[model samples]
Target: MENVTLSEIKRTPELLKQVESVPFKLEKGKRYLFVGCGSSYNLGYIAAEMLNKNGYEADVVTGGKIVALGDFPEADVAFFISRTGESTETVLAAKALKKRGIYTISIVCAKDAELSKTCEENIELPFADEESVVMTGSFSTILYMILRGIKRYSIDGIEGFLGKSFEYVDRLELKKFSHFVFLGFDELYGLAKESALKVQEMALQWVEFHEPLDYRHGPKATLTEKTLVVMYSKDTAYEVELAKELKQMGAGVVYIGKEGDIEIPYQDGFETPVRILPVQYLAYKKAVSLGLNPDKPKNLTKSVKL
Candidate 1:
């Protein structure tokens, strides 16, 4: 019996290919703000980092921050991201941003979502929608769509990449590991956070995410033989050393970089959508090893509605 989460993960490359032809555009010299919750928030965070790195001004704020603290950044345009487009805080934040006279755009995987209705413009990717509670393919699809808005890309060789990544994950002795840690920086940091969320959501496992160097500051105290560290590296010398250090501490390490256990060359954050796929597969495999169903995570719904 295959899980819906696995099915969705398997379909991601096709989804990316389909969305490549879809046009989404962004204007230059305009400050952009992104709003969302949970996985959606992580998506926005990565978008902001990439955009800023590319000379565009962008910032991301969690929908909860806007709804709870009444905090809003000044921007000519704001993008509200929600997979189902019904997340309560996101809708509320979109409404608030619209009220303040900023143009709002809804990037969602659902058709005619409430968040879409509230925004001045909507970028809907219904084709990327998923049935499972945990986000799999849709997350990558939406992120790819947004990245395409800035720079055109063809996800060439994605099939081979997926095949290799899944095969690598399959070879892991997943049951021996209880704690999972993901490390990265900047746009990769957003990916690291989302990777932790994937394992925590799908496998109900202990997980953590941190910037590569910051892990040594205070977090490495808990490292043990049962810990597995997934490093999303920028090919930095310091990060390379840290991987060796973590390994010496008896923690199993999966370094992801130009030369890594799972080699994924960083491409100025353009490769993020693809970079996330292996970790998604790892989480699904871990859930299966623990006799949990990744298709239906505990205490979660497809969308978080108020």
Candidate 2:
């Protein structure tokens, strides 16, 4: 795991250099589309949010949607994410977009993948060729790289963030949680989803992800003393209130960012998605502690051929 993360971290500079040199135009009126599968799909969701937050009109949709929907809105660029760069739906979606004269930019780990061939430009990471069926360092590293790119931050800033995040991961003891639930709102909604997936996929536990307020609507019924709710608190006051309520309900809630009065050291505030890494790493560590191999989750594969 360390090797995978280090390799990916080491490649950040080169990845940034490549993306910086890509010849493309991002106009204000142009729409941007993000497409991927599974974890990569979740990464696309984050990418779409980042793009939108940065003043670009962006939307996230699954690769299947792109293929089935056929004609899509005219866009300046489409960002396609696929870890293996071989997901069937993603490849087909890229091909579909290309047929429509849409410029496609791929974010993949496999530089030589078929999907890469279909894309006009691509950002490849070092976290390629996973040995596990469930994605771990690969998912986080790729997403982190995209986040850095979206923020247009310098490589130094990115490296500093990565260093702190790695330290946080090392300090956490994840085996304590018997069950876990991830919560977030708005942009962090995708973060919550990815965190929940990490827990379930890496830990092989039934973990749930929900909107902070939405949890009270119906999902709260499943809460108990045994359930560990990991909440990603944003800048909104409503989210803080929701976290407080959940804590009152006897649910062990760990707030991700320092927005609310109930703060955890792991909370670095909601400005960045790196705050979610602790829980992700914890889930992986917990799985390993339980004698489970997170690299190959049960009944799953690195790439779904169908």
Candidate 3:
């Protein structure tokens, strides 16, 4: 019900600091695991990608799957992402990992949540608590924090990328799209997934996500003049070809990133921190236009009880 833009805007610095403070030394051959539920699960996906991109071996799994599988690699560290820090499956997975003597970390909005209390480290997000049933700003802010945090610690040229991304968000007319699709490859897979989730949670739209090469598959059958396809151009040769194909399908296509003919100035290299902004803006603007409070999506609370 309140303005979330300010909070989302202010979160970058704090996120950078939180990421810097974490002790990252890992034993040789040890793995890293990221776990969460729902939007938090999406965060885990992003975190895992960031970690992998930074030369760490990391994998993402839903908290429920972690509990059911009962077997994980001997992780040197595990991260649990929960906005409220109290997701049932995340808490249980954290507890299970702790019992194995692994270092557990929590990225959460609630500083004093049970998950935070149980983990060895807690990174509290700057986004305000969401009162709606669906997650909007909370999901984006936390993910932005995670990406920014990774950029601060591992990647170079992140701040410039973040600034450019913010500027790009200011320019987008996000609510104009009636239907959406996100396409990407490699690490961009996480970005596309998060982008699709943002539309779904904040705007209540089921945005489709696909691998760039796979778009030619059966899924392309749904393409129409009304469809908006947002593709991440990760400096790949296939991007231009894929964009061309999608355009031929009679869908409006917006290509993101550098190294593409349809250049999006806000996107930079594959590692640029600003890459997340367009989708974030898309979610925010769509929420504003729909008269639905992005700060609170319907049927969504800060946390799931179980």
- Lowest lDDT 10-residue stretch of candidate 2: 261-270
> Which candidate should be chosen as best, given TM-score against the real structure?
1
Predicted structure 1, TM vs. truth: 0.98
Which parts of model 1 have CA positions greater than 4 angstroms off? none
Candidate 2 lDDT at 21 equals 45
Residue-level lDDT of model 2, residues 61-156, one tens digit each, is 788877777745566678888888888999999999888888898877766887898899887664344545666556655655655554444333
The worst-scoring run of ten residues by lDDT in candidate 1 lies at 152-161
Best by lDDT: 1
Show where candidate 3 strays beyond 4 Å.
5-28, 68-74, 121-176, 259-273
Return the TM-score for each candidate structure.
Answer: 0.98, 0.80, 0.79
Write one digit per residue (lDDT tens) for candidate 3, span 131-248: 4445544664555555554444344455565566556655655555678898877557767877887777777876898898898878888788778888887756687788888888
Off by over 4 Å in 2: 1-27, 68-74, 127-130, 148-151, 154-176, 259-273
Task: Report residue 228 deviation for candidate 1 (angstroms).
Answer: 0.3
lDDT of 1 by residue, 116-153 (tens): 99999999999998899998899999999989988888
Clash pairs for candidate 3: 132-300, 133-297, 133-299, 133-300, 134-297, 134-300
